[model samples]
Target: MSENQTIYAAFAEKLDAVLSALEMEGTLPPETNRANVSVEPPRDPSHGDLATNAAMVLAKQAKSNPRALAEQIVEHLQRDPAITSAEIAGPGFINLRLAPHSWIEELSAIAARGDDYGKSAMGAGTTVNIEYVSANPTGPMHMGHCRGAVVGDALASLLEHAGHKVTREYYVNDAGGQVDTLARSVHLRYREALGEDIGEIPEGMYPGDYLVPVGKAAADEFGDRYVSEPEAEWLPLFRAFAVERMMEVIKSDLATLGIQHDLFSSEAALQAAKKPEAAEAWLREHDLVYDGVLEQPKGKTIEDWEPVELPLFRSTKFGDDQDRPIKKSDGKWTYFGADLAYHMQKAEKADALIDIWGADHAGTVKRIKAAVAALSEGQGTSIPFDVKLVQMVQLLRGGEPVKMSKRSGNFVTIADMVDEVGKDVVRFTMLTRKPEAQMDFDFAKVIEASKDNPVFYVQYAHARIRSILRKAAAEDLAPSDANLDLLAEDDLTLIKQAAQFPREVEAAARAREPHRIAFYLYDLAAAFHAFWNLGNDDAAKRIIVAQSAELSEARLFLAEQIGQVIRNGLAILGVEAVEEL
Candidate 1:
């Protein structure tokens, strides 16, 4: 096997060779489907080092009992030098214990590929466009947008590490009514900046002080010229100015969390280019859209409702709850109409598309998916698209719900959270739970130094290893792979835990869940800590011994490799591996 090939990949190839041999010998039928065959670590460590279900999955095609097929597969597997023992367990599950040299070689591989370890080529030759953290350009980024931002950014890094060309995108919703309100609110602040003594902010206008800077900038640029102007005269100028300034603020806030996007597509730009009109024309030609009137809304009295003719898309044809409108009665494009055009624009540049959206947008997922499917089928292109909904994160401090931000006069802002707890703590804590599950972000609990804090636990593990290396250097002892034979069973056990990083990376990338990386790091840290505790009971079990420099050097080599794996995993998650607590 090549030095760069992961241990799991090597074993999987061996398993496939065994199956091919059976086919060639006529013991199993020719060209049997082997898609379901798998090689992975057994759930019970006592079972074996590796296990395969090739016999159980292929038994029917081979026309033999599963246990009988297992015997034949084992007979071929036993011939390999790497396999020390092969045993058949319940229901034809074949378990194989490997020679200790296999793991020792993997430890050497970890040293061979320091920073590049755990990366995979599974996503090669594909381009993925990931749209995330698209908060409306109305105010500063609050905690509401934090979870999706971190998840999307980490997933983008994970995909890139997995060898896909990834494009990070942020959609700017600047052409909405909320921005109009924002303009009106900024006008008041502009008047105040011009010494007009504008009274309390009225209802329906944004109340955040974060917009004051935009207003001050507007006043500085336009002077008293727009102080007494008509709403129609100043609204357009203020709207554009406010949106631009607010996006700047949003970008600064995202930067504090280490997030930056490759592109910022604008809703107003889409409208200005008439993309929605083109989409409607194509849908009409395909009979996917037509002029129609919606049924009266449910739970509304007839007197309280009125039907108006609108252009509707046949979303129900693709399993939506109902046909959705593409245009309002006033002939303006609806949100869905504009969004459909935006997705089509993205599809033009990538092989696959993924949107990281808040859970509140769950209701509109099906219609957008239907539109994309219709577009892909009509255009004769295969584009895989997915919408990952991130559940809400509740902010708390000392077990009580946190209050609103003084600056925003609304929810807590991302800048505030990052300022209070720090970037690493915020990013890592957000990923400790699944994106689809609601979680609490407690200020007091996340930074605690106990093992319960996963971020600290993982960092402490890396820091401890670094401290050991430094101490060993002071004693004139250094790590050396020359005496790897001196490593004991406890040392190899730690190596086994570190070797799982490659498999974890591939699995997490395939599942599109970056939280798996966080979970895996926590487990690896726990195993390292458990092994570190053994040296406290017996002086000979420690990594450094004054009398036995050969054994000490070999164990130091093992420690350094473990630290490297932790750093590689943390890099994929966008968390720094601290060398000191």
Candidate 2:
């Protein structure tokens, strides 16, 4: 097999050949739909090295019993020299045990491909636009935004590794009411910078000390000219100034976490360009938008509720609970209205769109999805869109919920988290669980030097491998695949574990979940550690067998490839694989 072709891919192709041979001999119908057939490692490792469900999925179509079909398929599969045995298990599952040389060849491929071993062309010819970490441009990034940021950024890298053209995007919500509040807050700070006693912050304004620099900078630049101006005259100027500076702070915080977006789309710019107006007009023309009055709000008693005619999108036609308003009573666009246009704009630039949003936005996902579906149908194209809701991360220091930061006042800033725990720890910890599940980020637990801590465990595995290599190098020994034939079954076991990287990459990319990479690395590390422990009981099982240089070289080569795979996985996760502990 070519170095670029993964072992699973090679076997998948071989399986296809066997199926085709069966077709040619009139055992199965020609042009059968084999989309449901899958090739993967069986859930029970003792079952076999690889398993496929071809006979089971195709039996009904082929007009034969599944076990009979499996018998025929196994006959063709066992003919291949690389396949040591093909067994029919339970009902119709075909499990193939491969010769050890096949896995040894995969280890050689891992060494040949190096960093590009697990990368695949599965997403080739696709352009994905991923918008993430779009915290309102009013303050520094906080812990609330950290999880989605890491998830989105890692997913972008994962998709890129899977061969997709990806655009990392951030939506700057500078046009919202929040920025106006930010402007007023900065004004108070600016007054304080001019030595005025502004007193305690007002009830409805941001109190973060992080904005003090923006206030002081404004005072030094403008020199009290805006200090005396009317609210109307200064609101626009201060709002723009504060947003620009706050975005700088946000960018810097993201930088500390090793994140940078290719595009920072501004809601104000989108509005100024009249994109929402155009979308409203198009939807209105197609009867998707109409002047309608909504029922009274639910679950709350409104003493003076009154009906008002609004331009509402017919989201109910596409699975939403109710039709949604595109415009408010005051002739301004609703958040959904603007967001719909934003997604439409993104859809124009890419074949698929993914939005990483906080769990708080879960209520609006349906309306937005409905809008995208309607718009895509109107445009005569099928654009795949997904909104991934990331749940909150509760911060803890010592088994107790951590208090809010003094700088941000409301929450822990991303900078503070990065400063407390390194970037790799924060990033890897955020992805340890599925994004939809709530997690606790306990400082004491995260940094613990034990196998229970995934970051430390995976990093230590790479470090231990490097330590092995260094000790061997100092003794005039280097990794040599020339003696791989001397490797034992235990060594090939680790190779089988490492060989799953490519399959995992494709599967994770298809599911749009980057957490799988972290999970896979942990398992791979456990397998390596298990093999390493075997040497503890018997010195001959060790990687560096002084009595046999050939076995040592072969084992060292295996160790080197395992380290390479770890480095590649960590790279996708934006984590560092330290060479030493």
Best by lDDT: 2
* Backbone clash numbers for all candidates listed: 0, 0
The C-alpha stretches of model 1 lying farther than 4 A from their native spots are none
- Cα RMSD of all models vs. native, in order, equals 1.1, 1.0
TM-score of each: 0.98, 0.99
- For 468-522, candidate 1 gives per-residue lDDT tens digits of 9999999999999998988889998899999999989999999999999999999
Clash pairs detected, candidate 1 = none
lDDT of 2 by residue, 165-200 (tens): 999999999997899999999999999999999988
Task: For each candidate in the order shown, give its overall lDDT on alpha carbons.
Answer: 0.93, 0.94
